[model samples]
Target: MFYFSICFMFFIILFLMSFFLFILSIIFLMMDMVYFFEWELVSLNSSSIVMTFLFDWISLLFMSFVLLISSVVIYYSKEYMSEDFNINRFIMLVLMFVFSMMLLIISPNLISILLGWDGLGLVSYCLVIYFQNVKSYNAGMLTALSNRIGDIALLLAIAWMLNYGSWNYIFYLEISKNHMEMMIIGGLVMLAAMTKSAQIPFSAWLPAAMAAPTPVSALVHSSTLVTAGVYLLIRFNFLLVDSILGKILLLISGLTMFMAGLGANYEFDLKKIIALSTLSQLGLMMSILSMGFLKLALFHLLTHALFKALLFMCAGSIIHNMKNNQDIRLMGNLVTQMPLTSSCFNLANLALCGMPFLAGFYSKDLILEIVMLSYMNLFSFFLYFFSTGLTVCYSFRLIYYTLSGNYMGSSFHLMSDESWVMLSGKFVLLFMSIIGGSLLSWMIFPISTMICLPFYLKMLTLMVCIVGGVMGYTISLVSLMYFNKTLNLYKMSFFLGLMWFMPLISTVGILNPFLFLGNFVFKSFDQGWSEYFGGQVLYKNLKFNSLMMQMFQFNNLKIYLMSLVLWLIILISLLMI
Candidate 1:
């Protein structure tokens, strides 16, 4: 517990240092200076494994933001986990996660990046299971194995990089752009990113990971684990530009966004709802990156990190006051009972919905405008706008259920915003969520965006927001009526509620066949054929040989005499011939 305080101080210092470095990096970017440092640790014939670090606006700025969020999370956890006996373990795991994120950010070599990537997967599993419960254990396994798929993909990528005789993939991005090996590596990298970012088939784990502690949820879902994929794509954007694989990524990301948005609408758990929103935002980032808008994706990634982390913290505070109850249906009128938390939550929700000039507005608006400006297929355009509307719909539904609806829980339960430490973290993030987008857009995108679109297309985002918000509110008002009327589309509702059966696909679809095959092999080989041929047959043969030897030994005289007579007869016959 004492060490927890030390960990908090350490992160605070790290945040300050990273913030200072971010300013310097911005100056360097402005001056058109690229800073790279490399040291060759081992060299072979035409091959070298080098330790490399890259300092650019992207890495530095992202690192700074990561450290900022981490510091706040640590401080917030001090209060959130105050009553827990294993606070030290929790804080340490978070610090380790932060270190891995920093390593992933700085490394230019794929081999080196794996150290950080695997570290994140490992530490996140630890954090997810911090509560030591059945639910947390299962969630941890799902999270770990899902991320293991990405780790394997990265390993495949590293193996393929051997063809270039170098592990520093950054140097080969342009040279191997047209090469088959690079294409294979690019596809594998995208798959790896998909798993890490919870895209499509890998999407179920993100929402399930809400079984973790809220601070861990904030860190893992907001920036550290999930966004690692987006950061990887941003670094590899040079190689992905105009590639066929990029288009595939665009399609997958669009689907992921839509799936998550729909799932969030069906979800009742407050934390899970926020988790789904993070998934949706991650999809948005990946889609934008796939379209070659690296800067825009990065901008959204940072701003989303700010608001999403803040959002999770606010959710944590509310959950804490509500005695660990997270069902949105059980909560209501929190705006009056817990004014500070409700305000922060509402503000973060608005930011998430891309309202006006909030942090989400700048990046999401730019992304939509860019999508409209570009020549895209109708599917991509429809997915982009539809997912956008879904985001608003879910956000409004969540707000209505948790903040404004009549309080449905027991009145004896005490709810208040008394934890200053928790509120302190939210306050810091609240300020950022409000202004972080405009500030980052200014710093990251110095030039004004050139947009020329029809009037309806330009107002598409606003219109969707309005329509979605109205629908969300209206549906919430009459939700009981619909619930009582018991429709025949229960299967459809179940499918949407379970994230389009992605979890089933990932778990049952993947494991059932293999489990069945394993059972078959075990029964046939271990119990039947292998038992007959290997153990039973060998035992029978050995027993028969032993019986023959025993008979020969017991009846030795008669057997010997007969053998001699036969030998004599055979000898006489040979001599006559």
Candidate 2:
């Protein structure tokens, strides 16, 4: 009873906090209306400390997703986390993540922005190891280490900028003019964003991060932390919109989406599959972000929060009832027994697969459309098509396998549907996923049309969405017939090979050479030091000199000083040129 009351009290506090923060967000959103509402450029004095929420309607929309996901994760935790784990500590870390993210959303200065950015990374590291086991500990360390490399790159970029004597963001309003510095800052910042967002070379940490609870996986990976990198880049669009590096980012993002989607389809571990899917979705957002589709990125971020969270939480519910079995192959025909859980999972998957009327359909299609509209080149169009096809292949892999596979697990009674709290949390997201299209088309675009890019520019983006969805769905169903081989090499062979190679290459390329050379140098120095001064003989000789000096030190200091002056002049004159 006491514990239950504590849980209740915790949520009450969260409710109040989020409500307060939301009100503040609204105020900040309106504070710079002239600058944000009008297309014309505006500047404030450097001395002015007024906060300016600079991101367009898109950023505000993403912030809404962050709040919704955070709230749901907190509510879901009551049932998700075991009592043995410190629930209060987890809750505290989660709140900190939310608070920091909100700060990142509204911060006007680079320093404040970095504070929020670093805070989220730290909180995520803590949450990753909330289980406090050896494996989780190692995973958390690696994630932190990888992100640290990106953080350092970001710091170097900031340092480069600050050296130019501009602390206000107004300086970057004309980023293209300073192409050299912009290239350096933009490249380094993109590297940081890629690492945080888990793009290639840094993508492996995400799958390992599933050591965290399902709720954390769902919340952090799907909606908030992973999407942060994309959010950061979008916020800085003025600098990147026409840069050479921006084009490279677009290409890399498309490849990442395709590769991650392929990886997700091949994965068998339930959490890991979802983890890869999270990466794939993040890649999709990044690809659009690279093309300057801020609205599409924000929309995808929002819809992804709903469906992906629902999918993960539902997976947790399945794992919870199945004694924590994580391999999807071990269980089947879950829909027959766990109807409510199955239904929710299916609905979420439908949204994920971009079925008509679902939230993902609109947001993801919008992104593709934007990319196509923004880039008329054949390379851009082909990349979008290929990535879209891959997205379909993976989304249906989950749908077909989970729903249509044979029932094989032991007969176990289903837990009741998610608690009223969890259900209500998802209910809000589900509603958003459904109505988000009309909202975007009718309201958000119209409002931001004046200040942002025009509405007619979005037409190509909308057309691509509709066309891509149909093509992707049709291709996936047809491709399944020819892909009946049971090798599953992508997971068993390729994934394992990549996993093994990371540490293996790190050791050979970095650690081994350093260890071998360092050991040889240390041994040589130790032997030389021993020969010269390591024994009692050396100590006795030093003692004898000290005794003689004490006994017969008649103006020795004067003689030494004379010799030192002579040596100094000879050394100075030799090098004077």
Candidate 3:
């Protein structure tokens, strides 16, 4: 326990240092100076592979938030994971994850970025499977492999960068602007980002990754793994700006946001609902980024990290008190039993729903406003607004099921906010959920946004929030009366509940075909034909020759004499010819 406390304190100190650095970075940004440091690692044929770090307000600010949240998570885990024998290992894995994220944040060179990218995937896989359960194992594999696709795409991008002299893509962005090679690199980078960010087809892994420990989920879904993709695109936005691929990315991200928002409404698991929300927010970031709003995306990313992490921590507290029951269906009247947690949970949910003055409002509402102002096709326009409404829809639904309904759990359970460590973390984040967005907006975007729109367009987001919230609450009330009645929308519910069957498509439709092909190859080519022809036939021939030699041993001299005479006769015939 003392050792864990020491580790927690160490992280807290690191986070403080990062916060100071972030302030310094802002000062530097204002002064028009950005820091760049590089060390040459290898040079071949005029192309140099260098490790490079870039320090600007964006990277520093993001790093500060990541460290801050990570510190809180570690502190929270000291209590959350106290009973687990391997708590130290879990903490260390999280620390490594943080370090990897920092590496990724600072790296300007694509070659060096791979170090952090691969490290994230590797460490996240370890964290996801920390419980050593079958579910965790499967989730870890899905998460790892899904992210691996992005890793490969990044590697391909790096390979393509070899066409230029240096792997330092930052230096080359302007020089190679709109070049075919650069476009290819941009396309590959977007694909990589998609995999990491859980956009569309790769989105299945995010919800499934809820099998990880709740703390890990909080870190991963909030600030670290899923956000890596958005950050990557943000870094590469110079090249992606106004590119055809960027428009395509916009469409896909919009769809992903809508998909995840709908999925959350049907999800039952507490953590999964939050996970899907993270996915939805990720889509928002990606879509906004695709519109070339890099700073806006970064702003939302930071704020989302704050409230989402807080939400997860609150969820963790509830799950702990509930003895690991995650189904919101079985959770009710938590407000009466665990007032503090319930309050924090409701606050975070409101933040998630983009309530007027909360953290989410500063970013999410602004994002919606920006989307409405942008020139977009009908499909994208509809997706953006509908997805925004769905955020409110699922959030209110979640609030009703968990906080306001009748007590649905066993009466023997005792719930309270006695854990100081956990409460401390939640309180810190709760304060942030209220003010983090407003604070960050002031710090990151000093100039306020200027929008020229009609009154209805301005009130569009507020109206959607109201309608969605009312519908969600009314549906939750209706659910109780019809609790035992068969839901006619079971098919639709099942589809949305299962993330539009993406997990099924990824695991069954996508993976099963390859699995079947592998089995067929192994059976027909490897075990059947290859085995019989190569190994079996060779063995049979060798055995036959050996047996024949054994039969004609020294004891069988007549056979040896006959073979010699036959050879001699063939030699004489050749000589005469």
| The best candidate in terms of lDDT | 1
Colliding pairs, model 2: 369-461, 370-461
lDDT of 3 by residue, 223-256 (tens): 8989999999998898767889888999899989
Across residues 508-557, which tens digit of lDDT does each residue of candidate 1 receive?
Answer: 88756766888999999998899998989999999999998888788689
Model 3 CA deviation exceeding 4 Å by range: 41-49, 519-574
The CA lDDT of each predicted structure is 0.89, 0.69, 0.88
**Model 2 per-residue lDDT at 214:** 80
**Error at 339, model 3, angstroms:** 1.6
What RMSD does model 3 have? 3.6
Q: CA lDDT of 42 in candidate 3?
A: 98
Off by over 4 Å in 1: 1-4, 40-49, 486-489, 515-577
Model 3 has a clash total of 0
- Highest TM-score: which candidate? 3
Error of 2 at 347 (Å): 1.6
In model 1, the clashing pairs are none
